[model samples]
Target: MIDMTTGNPGKLITRFALPLLLGNILQQTYNIVDSIVVGNFIGSEALAAVGNSGIIIFLLISMFAGIGMGAVILVSQFFGAKQEEKLRTAVDTIYIGMSVAALIITLCGIGAAEPFLRLMHTPEGATMEMSVTYVRTIFLGTAMSFGYNINASILQGIGDSKSPLLFLSIATVLNIVLDLLFVTVFDMGVFGVALATIIAQGTSFIFGAVYINRKIKIFRLFSHRMRFDSRILLQSFQIGLPAGIQNLLFCVGTIVLQRLVNSYGPAFMAGYSATNKIDMFVFMPILSFANAITTYVGQNVGAKNLDRVKEGVRSALIISVSTAIIMSILVTIFGRYLLMAFTQDAEVIKTGEEFIKRLMPGYFLLAIIFTLNSTVRGAGETFMPMLASFVSLLVARVPLAYLFNYIGGRYNIFWCYGAGWFAGSLIIVSYYLSGRWKNKAFRFVEEAEKPKR
Candidate 1:
């Protein structure tokens, strides 16, 4: 619908990527703002309660959010093909699947909250209690969060990335104000952090849902079409499930790393947690650009403009790699100041600064893997991503982390993140270059000249 196949890609990419980058950054403001309000208001240990659960939070919501990837793929293809009926089908179908997923995850959240906190070996005292309270509150809001992701993905697929950016900006700013008042004014502690995130996420979902209902002329909620279509569900799952599982595996691996971090005590835990927020700021833009390439590639490929897809990818690579190099330099230089922003602990700041120095070199490789995997997803190939993650997380990272703790020495643990990132990048890029996700990967390509329906 946006005619991505014929646009000047440099102009198109900058226009699309800039708003997306802003959206992603503002979306992260929920966390950065939470850390600032809490650490400054409460103290370092309480900050650790809110901070340390980062991976666990991803684990709870990621599966359903992955359906959003499927939504983007499905809707973008239909949009490029100008199939209005199918685009509407994608929106309705995604809500059904994601709602079911949200319910299941919520149940898991209710049951698993205490056990997970215990598993983290949280210290006996107020801090452990705070961790449990924070995690449960965040988990209860999974539906609203995933609902927003699914709807936003569908809209973005149809070329409306800016709308999500606009609404998220309002939500995140509200979240910041709430975090300050709840933690500083009312003394809510870690629960305030969770409450703020949920409120922000819920507000964003409501705004997006309402805006699309009245404004997006391409989509209309049809009551008669409320029932599930087995065919559509199956196709969506084919694209989304693997991506979801990749995220699941990645989260699992991080939880393992969190355990490793915990073994070093709360100071290390707080430091690692605080530094990671800084890391994500750099990661988000590259991620947003990767998403842009996915949409650009998806639209052109859907229209059967293979050359445009290829050229778009080429331009994207140059831009992405260049941006990653810039982040590497900035992170290396600003690493200490970032940690000091959250905690004034001399030891924690030192640990975090050292970690950042070790970590920046891997950002380029991480960017490469991100761009390539997103490209595969755009082309509707999710299996390689799933397999790549399985190997990277389960087979490589977790085991390597164990070995690092056991033999590579205690301080070498953070290096596991870098090593795992590099290995995953190699695995992802190798898979892409191996011609597996290429349309030619299917032997049926010669027999059937068009994408299989």
Candidate 2:
């Protein structure tokens, strides 16, 4: 674990972000592998099915995912404050809360799989069936998915990003092997891919739990009763609920957008799916910097090194924006080749290239928005970030997508992303300039000095 409370802001943020970038790349590979295998072996229709299900799966888990992020903020602050007992309690509270949430989401997701797909207007017959099968299989292992994420969040909270990367590397390799085995050898199709994902997730979770129990002296997973501390749980929800709502709004908007994409037919859907995987690579580095800064700010804020927090934000923006620009150029130049990795369909490749070209310019705006929002959230001011997302996704992007679709047809839909990012960046920049988030940071410092309950 590296300490960001005392270091050169630029070097610390870069070192911290590298492993996170790699880990996110590996995590995204799980879906990319599934798409590539299904698109090649099973066909485009199957690929489209997996892609459609991916959005729904994200929608299903997004709320808890946001809450898990909230837990990360709390843990980082506690760890930085050297509030060892509070940090342990926060960790335990997170696991207990997430376990219950996983069970509930699993039951609801399995039952709602077909209905949600229908609502999205997924192509009838084979595509619909495959989507439903894949969604249900994935939901069945929601606990494992939640477990792995919880472990990762706890470790990241403590400034240990590399361990999660190691665990994810294991899972990614295992997932690829299983994807080939189940899809090619057993002919399990989409079910095989989903099963591979959850099994790999379960393995990583178990491995992470055992590793933390033995190696991490500050905490233990199985050594004590996992119970919620009311104070920490309430504070977590206070910080997390807005993030959860923000994610829910974003998912709702995407679901609406997916419905629109579905109307364009399965081939277009397949193209869009492939491009989404490529998009993840473009955003990975920016997101890694955003996450790195969040922890950096949280630690510095806890240590009452507010000047370091300011320095870190500037360093993160420079690094992240430069990286974003580089990624845009690279993706624009070679996006067609990347699209071809998923399928050989000329139409899918053409459609994906068009999407990439239209969307690449907006990534700069997105890097700024994400980094700024992450900075505020690290200071324990989550509501403003949530509000910015609301304006960007619901108020700007979704409405503009439909308006553009009506005005210029399906190809115009991609332009809405830039508009949304612009809208979000405005909110984040204004909030950052207003300097209100520092007040939130000070509040956390005061809380840190209170006697442990």
The lDDT of model 1 is 0.77
lDDT of 2 by residue, 1-453 (tens): 878999799999999999999999999998799999999999999999999988788888888888888888988988888888878888888888888899999998999999999999999999999999999999999999988988888888889999999999989999999999999999999999999999999999999999999889987785567667777777778778888888888889899999999999999999999999999999999999999999998888777788999999999999999999999999999999999999999989988998898899889999999999999999999999999999999999999999999998888899999999999999989999999888778565466467767
Candidate 1 on 295-342: residue-level lDDT in tens? 886776667676676677778778888898898898899888878889
- Name the regions of candidate 1 deviating beyond 4 angstroms: 221-227, 440-453
Candidate 2 TM-score to native? 0.98
- Score residue 380 of candidate 2 by CA lDDT: 90
* TM-scores for candidates 1 onward, in order: 0.93, 0.98
Q: For model 1, state the Cα shift of residue 36 in Å.
A: 1.1
lDDT of 2 at 202: 95
In order of listing, the candidates' clash counts read 0, 0
